[model samples]
Structure formats: C-alpha cells, structure tokens
Target chain A: MSLVVIGTVAFDAIETPFGKTDKIVGGAATYASLAASYFYDKVKIVAVVGDDFHKEDIADFKNHGIGVEGLQIKEGEKSFFWAGKYHNDMNSRDTLITELNVLADFDPIIPDSYQDCEYLMLGNLTPQVQRTTIERLKNRPKLIVMDTMNFWMDIAMDDLKQTIKLVDVLTINDSEARQLSGEYSLVKAANKILQMGPKYLIIKKGEHGALLFHEDLVFSAPALPLAEVFDPTGAGDTFAGGFIGYMAKVGTVNFNNMKNAIIFGSALASFCVEKFGTEKIRNLSSEEVSARVQQFVGLSSFVIGQ
Target chain B: MSLVVIGTVAFDAIETPFGKTDKIVGGAATYASLAASYFYDKVKIVAVVGDDFHKEDIADFKNHGIGVEGLQIKEGEKSFFWAGKYHNDMNSRDTLITELNVLADFDPIIPDSYQDCEYLMLGNLTPQVQRTTIERLKNRPKLIVMDTMNFWMDIAMDDLKQTIKLVDVLTINDSEARQLSGEYSLVKAANKILQMGPKYLIIKKGEHGALLFHEDLVFSAPALPLAEVFDPTGAGDTFAGGFIGYMAKVGTVNFNNMKNAIIFGSALASFCVEKFGTEKIRNLSSEEVSARVQQFVGLSSFVIGQ
Candidate 1:
C-alpha cells in the first residue's frame, strides 16, 4: 500500500526577514511528499508541472525514494510560479505575483500501479479538483486527510463543504476555522464543523501550535518555539505530509496515533521554517528528527501529585 | 509560612456577550487570595478598601480561611471601581469607566502577622508600589511572582524594569512581552526579559495558553479551551494566585514544581472565566479542581513509540 499526495508541484520566489530566494522547488505536494517520505517508504505524488521544471528537481523526489509516475510535466508551458514577501512578524504575507500558467487547467491523474492507496493527503487545492481526485480512485483510501485554504472557503464554500464531507480529516488555520464555522470559540467551531462530516478537525495556529478534535476528544500539540522563523512557506504542507506519512507507517486510524502524528508533523514543520522552501526538510537525519521530537516532549511534559 | 497577595480589593462592573454584572467584589488581591486559598491554606490579602465595601465581602475572605489583617478599611472613602465591556471575541475590551477613590495616593500597610510571608504575589499595580512591598518585608520571600500589564509599561517602564529585577518570576501577556523586549519572536522576547531581572518569565497567551522561559529551559502550558468566557476580569490574578499558592503548598521552588504549579494555576483561571466575576471560582470543590487538572493532562498527553 502507498500514501498518495495530490496538489501543486511548481516554483516559488520567497522573501523573508532572514533573506530572499530565487525560484526554488515548492508546492503543497512537493513539501508534503518529501515530509512523508521521511516516515513512510512507499510515497507517491500526483501533481502537474511544466516543461520549465528542472530535471534535477524531479530526480530529487526519486532520491528520497518517492514515486513520481503521477507527476505530469507539460511539454511547452511554463511551471506555476508564485512570489510573496513576508512581513516583519512573519505571521502575515503579501502576494507579489501569481503566474498560474500550468495549474489553472491542470488535471490530476492517479497511476494504475498506485491503486492500492492506504492513505491520501489532499493538499491545498481547488475544491472541485480535490473532489475529482477522490471520485477517480477505484476504492476509497483508509484515511483521507484534506487540507484547504481560506481562498476556497471564500469563493467555493458549497463545493468545499461537499468535499469536506467526504474526507475523514480536515485541516485549516485558526481564522479559516472561524470563517468556516461562523463561531468565535474554537470549541464551538470544532463542534459545528464535526457535524458537517469530517470525523476529525485539526486547527493549525501557526506559532501557537495545532489542536486535534475527534468526537469529544481534543489533543493540543505544542509548536517548537524558534528564535526566528526563516521561511514559513510550505510549513503547513510539510505538517500535513508528516501527519499522513506517520499514519501510513503505523497503519492505525485512532486518536492516540493521530496525536503522535501531530508531534511528528510539528517537528518536520519546525525544521521547514529554518530555511527557505523545503531546504531544511529536504535533508533531515532520523536522529535529528528524533531529537526534535524529544524537544517537544520536554516542552510540554508535566506531572501532578495525586 | 504564608502567601501574601498585594493589590486592589475593590469592585468591577463587567459586560460580556453572555451577560453583565454590577459592582461585584472583584480585584487583584480579592481574586488572587481566593484562588490561592484553594491550594494554600494560609493565604493573606494586603490592600485598601473603603467603608462602602460590604462586611459580607470581608466575611467571604474569612470564609475561605484567608487572612484579611493587612486589608485596610478607609473610613468614609469610596473604593476603587472599574467598568469595562468585552468584545465578541472576548479577547479585547473597551474601558467604560475608572474611579480610583481610595486607591489614589494609597498606602499599603503590611500587618505584623504578615511578616512571616514565605511567598509573595504582587498583582497588577504601580511598579513603585510593587517594589515598596518587597522592601517593607522583614525578610525576602522564598519566591516572588509579579504580574504587570501594558498600562505600566506605557507609563512607568523605568520603574517597572527596576522592580522586575527584584522578583524571581514575572508574568505578562504576549503583547506586553513583545513591547518590553522589543522583539517579535517570543523566544527572543523571553530571553531579553529574563535578562531584565526575573530568573523566569511567563508570557500568557490567554486562550492559547502560557509559556514559561528560564535560561535555556522553556515549558508550555495549555489553556483549557472553553465554550464560552462569561467574564475575564480576574482570570490573570486567579492564575497568579493558583501558581504561587501551588508553590507554597509544595514548599519548594524548582522547574518541575513550577510546571505543576502552572497547570494548577491554569485550572483555576479556567474556572474564573466560566461566570460573571468570581461566581464560578468562588465555590469549586477539590474534586472539581482535580478533575479539571486531569482534563488538562488528557488534553495534552501523547506518547511516541520507541
């Protein structure tokens, strides 16, 4: 069985307080698949790129033992490009440019050999396309974790809700959770969203950390506080990737496992922010990841006397 | 021998989305001492009120087995009164009125019975007053926890810095940490603030939780996510009281104890916001507090496989 990640595979130019970078390999699928490869061996990607995409970048995926049979490269068009600059706080950013040359009319195609999908991670994408990927699969994956942004909720909420109902887990940021549920309290928001279909809801609070809600259970994971966030791009996707990757490795779909997965995901995302794009996450030793996970254990562990 | 709480013990009129309250017995010392009473038996208050202050309110302190020997009753003078209205989010508020009657040019008189203080909680008051309390003590307490706000930073930063150096622990919300340290990153902010005076610093994030920072050690405490915050008037004070009170009960000052103390403090603060003023926190049984602490343990506990 394999873990399939479907989303954009494109280029990004980013600027942060630390520095700026030229067009580097970035996208929801790229970050997610790379993160998943660290935990699970059988990882595959389903995304559309362009002729402008470098050969070495595709080889990089293979270097991590990731299958790219579903990564489509258009012959003549340029790859999707995005440019953004982060503010001083790094919490907010401004989009400078968006050249969606290949992503605009892209179609996701699942490979025939990848039909035995056990876990699926639908990275941030159009609600309609995300739904189409699910429909095209011959059999539903054991666990479907879908990540989306506020942009879709703003324009295509009805379609978003429909897709949301099909997934087992839905992940969104704090403001997006507020927008989707129309509730100020997260406890109330989680209650309302759970009724909308997903069995689990993950609210990503960026620096504060992430919270997981399943039925009446809530698990709060602490984010590794950094002296500085070098780059925030792809951190969320990295988190989603690590989460599903760990799930696939354990082959479990329960609250306890999901809680551990969040810490693993948070550790990977913590490394992702130390450098631009996926530079920090692309090369992580198993030892380094284990040590980082321990840091989280130390940051939040406490014992009370009876 | 005792935990001395020094701050206002007057009245507050609050308006929240759930409801509103008239002039209730709400103040830093009142809330702190009450919360401290739950964990530490010998809790004492040091503040000034007026003849208008109800006799039953003074009886309430005694009811909790709290000492009010240091609480001065000014004859024929009105007590300090504050009125505020919370916004929809329950995070921001607008002050409607502030009448500092007995508090103006007030003198804090420590009773001889309070000379055996072992732990001190200096609530939100003028920096000079916070410093004077420390100076007047016959012997320095084993641990001193001082809480302040942005209002003091805006007006009396110089005095604030001087007082902060004398305390063992300092607690302020996230924004105030950023303002005082001139750093956006909380990790960096905590580092700078620790250099100011206190060996440990806590940046309170309200609903998000609280962070404890020492030299190189950091601890994150999760706040119980509530369905609704009826009133947030004295939550911070209640947290401080719970923290120092737990420390006094344990009879030790260390990182491990501080972590457990924070959990206890968070539990008390969680109950403080459940109703208008102190209605919810006034009458919690030991069983309820223990159960709430366990909920926090359940909310954040997770184990990673070896």
Candidate 2:
C-alpha cells in the first residue's frame, strides 16, 4: 500500500535541443516518487539534499502523497547536481558535469514514520547504501525492486554483487546486462543474471524497448516512438517508480500483473524523456499517464493467426 | 490457394559449433517453399539446376502439396554450389566458396502448369531476374512479397530501387535497413523506406526480434529465445515465406492481419536456425508451429489499466 524509495533528491541542469533548463527539481526520489505516487497513494522518500534544494520541491512530492520526512537537509551544503546534454538521437547522452556536494556524504536514515511502507525502490545508487536500507527495514516488504547502473559496476562490483543478491528484482540496461553477465545475447544475459540472485530481471534497451525475464518466461515491451526525445536522464528511475507504484496499488506479484506494471513504467518513462530532467513527468496527470499506457497497450497488442 | 516461388535451389556445406553438415540442401527457394508450403497445400517452384543436383534434392519439394515443375535441368554442368562457415554466434558467417554453376546466365521460365498460382514469392536474387519474372506472369498474382539482400544493394542500387517500387512488401535486416535508408535509427529508416513505395517494411534483427514498420506504426515481435542456434542462413527468407503464405491463406491485407503474419513468420524463422540449413525446418509440422505461435502470443500479451 506504500513504497519507500531511497535515492537522490537533488537539482539537475539539463540541456536539450528543445530548450535548456536551470537547476530544476530532479533526482531518483524526485522522479520515482512522482511516478509511483500516481498508483500508490502513500510514498516515503529517504534521501539527502543540500539546503539550496527548494522547499517547493518537497511540497510537490507531499502534494502527491509522498512523505518527505526522511529527506535530510545538510546545513550549508549544496545538493547533488548533474548537468547533461542529449545528442540529436536522444537514445544515448553525455554527462557534462556532476557535483556530488551533499550527496558525497549521504547517510540515508529511514524515519520511523516511513517504516510502515511495504514496497521498496532503490534507484541507481551506491550498492552499500542500498543494502543498508534493506537491512534497516522493520519488516520484509512484499517486494523489493532495485535499479543500478554501470558506474557503481566499474568501481564497486563486489558491493554491487552483494547488493544484487538481496533484491527480488534487478533493472539494468542492455549493455549493463552484457557487462554484468559477459553474455552477448540478452537471453543468455538474463539467465546468467537471474542466477546472481534476483527473481526477475528487466533489461532496459532505451529507445529500442525493454525485456522482462523471470526463469523461463520473457515479456518484451517497446518504447513509444516519440517524434522527439529531448532528454533521457531519469527515464529509467521514473520507469522503476511507475513499475513499483503500480504493483503497490494492484498488490499482485504474478507475471501477468508484473507485465502490466512494466508497461506502466514504460509509459511514464516515455513522458519523462519528452522534456528536460523531470519537467515532463513532474506535472503529468494520471489521466495522461493512463492514456499513454493505453496507447502502449494498443501498440503492443496485435492479433496473430486470426 | 497455391503459390509459386522462384530462386536458387542449391547445395550448401555449413560448419557450426553444434555440428557440421556435409553438402545439404539450401537456397532461397528451398527454405522459402518449405516454409510457405506450411500454410498453403500446393506450391510450385521455378528454378534451374545442373547435372550435379541430386534427384532427392529435386524430390525434396515434390508435394505433400508443393510441386517442382519449373526446375530446368542442364546436363554436363554443376548445380549452384555454396559453402559457408558459421561463427559460434551463427549471426555472422564467412563464405568459403561460391560457384554459380548452371545458375550463371541461366533464365527462369515458369512452367505452364504453375501459371494459375494465386500467390508469388520472389526470393532474394538478381534484381533484373526478379523483375523479369513479374513481366512473364500471365496475370498479376493476388499479392507479391519479395526479399532481397545488401549485396544487390551495392551492385544494383538503381535496379533494386526500381524493383522495390513494384513489390507490396520488402524485408531486410537492420544493417540493410540502415544502409538503404541512410539513417541509423530504425524509425527514421522505416519512414524513408516507406516513402520509396512498399506499403510495408519489416526490419529483422536476427536473434533480437523483428519490427514491422508501416508509416508511423511499428509492431515488434520478440524472437523465441533458443539455447542453440546452429545456423542462421535462410532465416529471413523463411520469415518472409511464412508471412506471405499465411496472408495468402487468410486472404486479407490489413495492419492487424499483417501483425499475425509477422509472428507466424518469426515462429518459422526461429526453427530454421536450429539445424544446418533447412534441416530443422524441413520436417516441422503444423502442430509444432501452432505451439510456437501460442508461445509468441503468450510472450507479447499484457493488460493495462484504462
């Protein structure tokens, strides 16, 4: 009924062909909380931010039924800052700058008020921090879905592997799947990664699509072919939010139900990329999100042998 | 309804990690006819062979429903011979030898008995030859689906372009899609190719899957992941064969109908690579194919909230 998302709640300056944005409200917790809150009425965000991070940003999440009591504000410290530019294609991007600031010494502390959440979403973060949050949980959540990237993979593989072993599901892109599993084909990669610990593996292929693999079952969902993908940052986290959020609401762990959750995640992620940072996803209404999900359902549905 | 397929019917020696096959039956028409015959009862093939071509090779296409009538035999000449070695991946291969024996300067003349065929498949071949067959047709068949490769793309760009203008559908792989459209993104590639004349464009991604792009609508069919893929030769043509053949059987040409056709085509192609050349697909029965189609249906199906 509730989710506790542990990740960045910071500022991002993003540049895209469509336009440029000054430091706007962006972060894993920011995006994920907004996406998940659409389906799950209660969301608790546990993250650290600089004093400069706007209180209005906190208000935004609070308005969406997300509790910000666990988001720590470090005195005189700037928030985690990221600046990135998207290429013309928008599938791949180049990070221009990253200022760790308050995030450099982030010590996530789950507040007592948020301990009742039943679902967990660990956005791309340090493996150690992800593991610590899980150990601190008062009770085992119904499900834990975590997203990790190649950054921690290169430097903290040992920690990453340990962290991966604890989660119910793992989300990694195609290249990460290959990098982690050393398998060129994703089918092989999923099989190898599933052995690493997670019960389910979702291989996100950016503009191409995403794959859901559990044991012998596999489901593929294609990205909406939008005319423009202004910025891709946080699309994956937003997808994670939408996925866990929907699952929290539906309260189903069946593969058939999870399949719907992935599509919902994909729908939210599609909206996130259409604008810089989380601008497009921030104000997206449930009706709009539901409409996009329906479109994806339409795009994915086709009768065969009829 | 019956169909006519015209292309090389030849001998192939292939080496793969799974095992090696001595000179085995292969070629566009060989794979295409066998795959297409799965849908329609009778399929007549027009091709030329030489003294070296075996009687069993000729008998291979003799009907359970398929009839080999236009196969012209030339004495004192060798049959079209090809030898290739498949890599461990099976997606790439190196041609060890190519001896275009009686196929050199050969002319294809459809037998009078095969003229009444309602469907036609112009498998990958010389662009001029494909055009010539169309010119010789007594009446335009119900529908024509053509498959061509990148080799002709370099040598006969003009002829291929002209031939493309006449075909109802064109099937090519990702690289060919990029090369033909001069775009890296497949969506952009399909948009440009759709303007060239073919109402439908299917881009094959080998083991990944296939994309059916018509205007802005793109339907992706995930390939059935197999633990082993011995050889990938003829998979694309086999996909095309199943596609057009199923359509001809159902007698419809809508977006929804073609969607099923792509799945049927993908199912047939998935089996083609399980053995060397056409061996795996040769003895394939409708029951096995039905099971695979059900798997495809299961793999791509999902539900979304309204």
Question: Residue A54 of model 1: what lDDT?
Answer: 95
TM agreement with the true structure for every prediction:
0.99, 0.94
lDDT of 2 by residue, B6-49 (tens): 88888888887777788887889888888988988777888888
Index of the highest-TM-score prediction:
1
Q: Over the stretch A109-216, how does candidate 2's per-residue lDDT look in tens digits?
A: 988887787899998889999999999988888899999999998999999999999999999998999899988778888999999999999989887678899989
lDDT of 1 by residue, A1-306 (tens): 999999999899999988899999999999999999999999999999999999999999999999999999999999999999999999999999999998999888888988998899999999999999999889999999999999998999999999999999999999999999999899999999999999999999999999999999999999888999999999999999999999999998999999999999999999999999999998999999999999999999998878
- lDDT, candidates in the order shown: 0.94, 0.85
- Clash pairs (backbone) in predicted model 1: B165-B197
Candidate 2 CAPRI grade: acceptable
Residue B115 Cα positional deviation in candidate 2, in Å, after optimal superposition: 1.9
User: Positional deviation of A67 in candidate 2, in angstroms?
Assistant: 2.0
The parts of candidate 1 lying over 4 Å away from their true place are none
